[model samples]
Target: MSRVTILVYKGFQVLDATGPAAAFEIAGHFGAPYSIRLASLEGGRVASSSGIAVETVPLAEALQCELLLIPGADNPLRAARQKELLTAIADAARSGRRVASVCSGAFILAAAGLLEGRRAATHWAAVEALKRLHPRTVVDAESIFVEDRGVWTSAGVVAGIDLALALIGRDHGDELARKVAQKMVVYHRRPGTQPQHSALLDMVTPDNRFAPLLAWARARLSEPLSVERLAKEAALSVRQFTRAFTQATGVAPAKAIERLRVEAARAAIEAGADSLEEVARRTGFGNGDRMRRAFVRITGQPPLVARTGARREPGMRG
Candidate 1:
């Protein structure tokens, strides 16, 4: 059996440790050999940022596990300053054990010198801070998670589940990971390359006037969603619809459509077994070139790079 240890400290995000622990536990029920435990710098109950306390073993005792997980906190910089904790993490990685962090826990890993010159992911809000603090590390601001060599890092909160699913898939098989994910009721596992933010959510607020229209546009991405078509669907003149949409969502109708198309295309590129041309066609980009341009504009990378980063290992689950 592979022993998995999650290291925690005061103020750690509760989900970062528990979510992955749940995923690993469920995978065990599916016949994967995993033994899970929670550990802290000193054995006892550690209070989380949410005011919930969890019992833990001493970190030194748990350091020899097959996998070590570091959970982020509300203010990870404070945790990163724990010299002994950082030393333990650095020693574990140097011994060739797989190590991973969830959310701002990447800051701790970076502090331990584990993420230097490696691609890592953290909570979006902490991306710039991480980059500024650890200039040698490559911070991927958008990925749900990132695995470079034996080190892994995930974005904020529930993304720890996605990171766990990926690790389970790597250790066992994609089928087992999928079953575990189904048991957990997540997306099967969102690809690590999938952006943490959604274009639809970014574009519309809860009570925005055009929420329904945006949802409709998303459902019919293959259809020609011109400003006139959207205006007609909304039963407003093109001028009024354009003005209201810009005011409500802060972007022009055409730009919004392009963002939606890029978002859909990106999902298809990362998870679907479709060619770039087919994904472009299905998402209303018409061709790869147009899709590429939109992807660069919206995602800051081309579809090919996204696909390569997402599927770096063949048969790897999301």
Candidate 2:
């Protein structure tokens, strides 16, 4: 069995730790050989930025484990503890254990000297800092995440969730990961090649009451649902709704709709839709031609290849 440890610190981001934890948990349900425990430099409860407290085991207890996960916290100014945390990550990496980080946790790894001369990534805001601090680390600010050697790094917030799903896929299989993602309602399997710079969801803005509107549009993807209809459901003027939607979700309303339609088409095709035209009609793409272009744009592959259930060959790094 693989033992995994998550390193927590003061004022740590809660989602970063919990999202991957949930992934590993679901991964384990598929008979994945993984066991997870939360660890800290010292064993105790650490406070999160959201006021929720998390208890953890000691780092000393996790040293012999197969994987170590480091989560970034809100308090990056805690230089001393950050330094100590970096040293531990470096030590674990040098010892041949798999090491991973969520968001700004890449900074801690860089501080420990493990990221030198290696490709890495972090949250967009911290990408410049990572590059400046570790001159040898090739920082890709737009990647949703990166896997270098045994060390993996994810971009801001929910990208960590994608990294975990990908890792689960790597350890077990794509089918198992797909099951876990379905259960978690993640909807999309944003690959490492996906751009992290684009905002796709509006969960951060509590005031944007667009979930129902989005769901309504999602159901009628096979219809001529236009921006005018979507804005009307939100009860706002077209210009106002478009601006607010873009501000909250990070993508233009039209692009978001196209993404939803493409995702729906892929699901339909995977479920054995009679033909590409049928899949497109069911997904609101109107025709196979549009669906084909959207599929290539979003997934870097044609609809036929995706519908054929072509299994992705894992990249072996020995």
Candidate 3:
């Protein structure tokens, strides 16, 4: 069995640590070979960002392993500065075992000099921060996970499960990985190459400046949604509205509108709604072919593939 030691720290994101831990446990339950342990620098009770506490061994007790995972914390930037923690991670990296990180935990790895000149991934929201903080690291916000050299980093939350699945696939095989994912009720095991961003999440900005316009546009998707029309709704001229929308949301009005449409179409498809052409029309895609094109461009898959996979999933859909 591969001894898997996951590092924990105060303020750690509970899901970041526990989600991958659950995946490994489920994989082991299905007869995969992984002996998992949790360790922190000081050892004992670790407070998570979610207000829960978990016990951990001292870093000395769990220094070396076949794999060492560092899960992200709510304040990873702050956590990464701890000299003892960085030293422990550096020692683990030097032990010649595979080292990986989840979410903003990549910041820890980078601080330990483990991710220099390597392609890495982290929470999409933290991509800019990671890049700005670690110029030597190549950050890919578009990816669910990335592996370079012997180090792996996964983008936020549930992506850590995908990273664990990848580790299972690496140790065993794809079939075993799929089985473990199924047992965890994760349904589809999204590949590392899958995009980190969800169009729906990207479109649903909090305190959105164009929230009113977006809501209005969503209700009238099939209606002509020209930039001029959107500007009028926002009480601005087209140029002003375009600039403001792009600055606030990092997406232009047209792209944001398309994302909203895709979200609607995807919901319909997942619900087993029949008639692709009809779905497209109702979702403002004009036609099935156009919808297919949009899905391919935005989601890296055709609507048929996504819908079929969603229907065939045995448990929670990815």
Candidate 4:
């Protein structure tokens, strides 16, 4: 039985912390290996961005946690309180718990010196701020979340939900994680290397300039999608297309294509592809070797491991 402690501080981004907490509760319903507890640096109640108050137990009381989650907040400029938060995080780390962060929660982990010489990810808007605070940490703005060793860090806001699902998958298995995700209506799972934001728009608007292009690419996940082809389709020069694509999507075209293909492959695999080569070819990866490389690059695993160790149960054929 694993135990989890979620640390909430003042002015915390409510969704960043609560989203994952809620998802974990769904996992709990399936008898997953977790006992959830919410904690705070200061004992008693903690306030959220939306003026809602949530109960918080003392951090010290959560002594036996297998995982400790630190949530980000709107008021990251609270430098004084940051020290206290960092101290608490360090204590949690010393207790052998896998400490993780949501959004600017990476800031807390960095302050605790847990992210030193480690690769982490955070909200794209805070990339510069995180860099200035902790120069030694490699902050990848592109990723939705990162799990290096035992320290996990996620992108801003709702990306925390995805991070928690990944943890569920890691601790228990893919089947439970997928069930939790399904229950929560998280139709897709973003790999750690996938971009934090969507490829269609910088924000969540249906009127984005690249909406059509995004739809086009998504509709044809089984086709070859090279930079040149995408550029041509967008009627722009390669450099221009790359810059515009990144600006609009928060990710490069090539990266987006890889993500789409991987997602398609995962769906196909979960639907019971006969072999790696079949999954690869069906997802436009051409062959098992290419699929293996892409799997390693995107998911930090080989083809076989990703298939068997996926977070979803193998379903009926697609």
TM-score leader? 1
The residue pairs that clash in candidate 2, if any, are: 221-284, 222-284
Q: Which regions of candidate 1 deviate over 4 angstroms?
A: 202-212, 222-224, 233-235, 244-251, 274-309, 313-318
All candidates: CA RMSD (Å): 3.0, 5.5, 6.3, 6.4
Question: Per-residue lDDT for 18-100 in model 1, tens only?
Answer: 99999999998999978998999998999999999999999988987989999999898888999999999999999999999
Each candidate structure's count of clashing pairs: 0, 2, 0, 1
Cand. 4 TM to true fold = 0.70
Q: What is the lDDT of residue 122 in candidate 3?
A: 96
Distance from true position, residue 172, model 1, in Å? 0.9
Report the lDDT of model 2 for residue 302. 88
Better of 2 and 4 by lDDT: 4
Model 2 has an lDDT value of: 0.77
Better of 1 and 3 by TM-score: 1
In candidate 4 the C-alpha lDDT for residue 96 amounts to: 76
TM-score of 1: 0.86
Residue runs of model 2 more than 4 Å from their true location after superposition? 77-81, 197-221, 225-279, 293-318
- lDDT winner between 1 and 4, please give it: 1
Ranking of predictions according to TM-score? 1, 2, 3, 4
Q: Sorted on lDDT, highest at the top, how do the candidates line up?
A: 1, 3, 4, 2
Q: How far is candidate 4 from the true structure (C-alpha RMSD, Å)?
A: 6.4
Alpha-carbon lDDT of model 3: 0.83
C-alpha-based local distance difference test score of model 1: 0.90
